[model samples]
Target chain A: EDKVVQSPLSLVVHEGDTVTLNCSYEVTNFRSLLWYKQEKKAPTFLFMLTSSGIEKKSGRLSSILDKKELFSILNITATQTGDSAIYLCAAPNNNAGNMLTFGGGTRLMVKP
Target chain B: SQTIHQWPATLVQPVGSPLSLECTVEGTSNPNLYWYRQAAGRGLQLLFYSVGIGQISSEVPQNLSASRPQDRQFILSSKKLLLSDSGFYLCAWSKGWGIQETQYFGPGTRLLVL
Candidate 1:
């Protein structure tokens, strides 16, 4: 069975703190890993990591993939209340028409 | 630029009642469309996907059914609603057939069943 697991299901931190969210997966054929941020109703695309050892960054957010360990991590630096949301990690299920298999997600709360 | 739209931002339905949710995309053609449901504080569960017109692929078997009537339009319908069916429904579109593409999601429709 292919599944993705996230660590620290919920976290609360003060503004300006740095947080690392983890995601590990076990799948038959791994193609790519994606990260999304869900604020209220919709989830916006954050980053997509295909090759290991390559880091993808946008502003204060960064992510890396470790295929050997079957895991990925998302780091948010200089956190603000605007960054509070549910972070989701997902990967393509190679056996199932490339359908994405998503992790349970990590709820992040940045307090001022 | 591509955008997806979902109707009836919020809906309150009763158990055993019918359901009809619509999603349409603009500025793109022959794009891959997907429908997903998210429970409160939970991850997304893919319900259906369409590669092209008149093509519907279901990821899970449930009370819900989907249809792609046009190139950029996808619909999710249920003969009868269930309490468990209430959730946030989202529609997404990707550029091509490959899974390596990035998916853009709509604002989403919140369904509450009593």
Candidate 2:
């Protein structure tokens, strides 16, 4: 079975602090790693990383995939209270019709 | 642009009751559909996926079953509900069967079985 593990299951930080969320996976025919942000409802797409060492960024959020290390990291710079939510990482399973195997997710609490 | 729709937004049912959750996609043709369950504070668990009509693949063997009656409509059904089945159900779709495609999700339906 494909497995994805994320580090620091929960974290609390003050506004303006930087946080890094980690996700590592073990799967066959790995294609890409994706990051999502979930507030109260559904998760919203953040970034999709396909190649190693190339970082995908959107405003204060950025992510990079290290295929050789079988891991990915999401970096949030100058975090704000609005950034508090569950950050999810997922890897697509090639043999399972491209179904995503998601990590347990990191619950971030940003306090102002 | 494509969009996925799932309803009702929330439901509370008694045990042994039947279940039918519907998912439909618009502005897309022959897309790959999927059903996922999310327990409290946990990640998504893949329940079923369909590549085409009448083709369903289950990732986990449970009391739930899925069907694709049409090209863009997928339904999840259970003859009898179990208390453990209570959770947030999500519906997703991808452009194709390729490994590189990204799956877009619906708002999800929260089901509570008491």
Candidate 3:
């Protein structure tokens, strides 16, 4: 079974604080890793990591994938109240066409 | 710009009742569509996916089924609803089927089965 596990299921931080969310997975054939931000209803895309050691960054958010260790990390720097959301990590199944396996997600609360 | 739309943002239904949820995407052609369910405090579960019109694939065996009649329209249906079916249903679309592309999601539909 392909499984994606995330640690620190929930976190509370003050504005301007930096947080690191972890995601590790076990699957048949590893293709790529992705991150999403869910506020209330729908999840928006964040980053997709396909190569190891190279980090993908956007504004205050950045993510990196480690293929050898089968893990990834999403780091949010200078977090703001608007950054409060559930951060999700996922990877596509190699056998199934575009079928994604997602983590439980890390609930982040940024207090102003 | 691409956009995805889902109808009936919220729904409440009784057990054993039939259900239908609609989703449509625009500004894209022959995109890959997917249906997913998110239970309380759980990860997203893939229910179904379609690569093109009239092509549907079931990722999980459940009371729900999906159909893609048009290239950008997908529908999720259930003949009989179950209590376990209550959750946030989401629709997503990607560019192609070969690579792991970023999926654009719809606003989502919250279903409550009594």
DockQ score of candidate 1? 0.62
CA-lDDT, candidates in order = 0.90, 0.92, 0.91
Model 3 steric clash pairs: none
- TM-score order of candidates, best first? 2, 1, 3
Q: List the residue pairs that clash in candidate 1.
A: none
Better of 2 and 3 by TM-score: 2
Q: Indicate the residue-level lDDT of A75 in model 1.
A: 99
Give the native contact fraction of candidate 2: 0.62
Model 1, residue B4: C-alpha shift (Å): 0.6
Query: Residue A81 lDDT in model 3?
Result: 99
The residue pairs in collision within model 2 are none
Model 2, stretches more than 4 Å misplaced?
B97-100
Give candidate 2's error at residue A107 in angstroms: 0.7
lDDT of 1 at B67: 96
With candidate 1 superimposed using the best TM-score fit, by how many Å does residue A14's alpha carbon deviate from the native? 0.4
TM-score of each: 0.96, 0.97, 0.95
Give the per-residue lDDT digits (tens) of candidate 1, residues B1-114: 778999989999999999999999999888888899999988899999888899889989999999999999999999999999999999988875354467889999999999
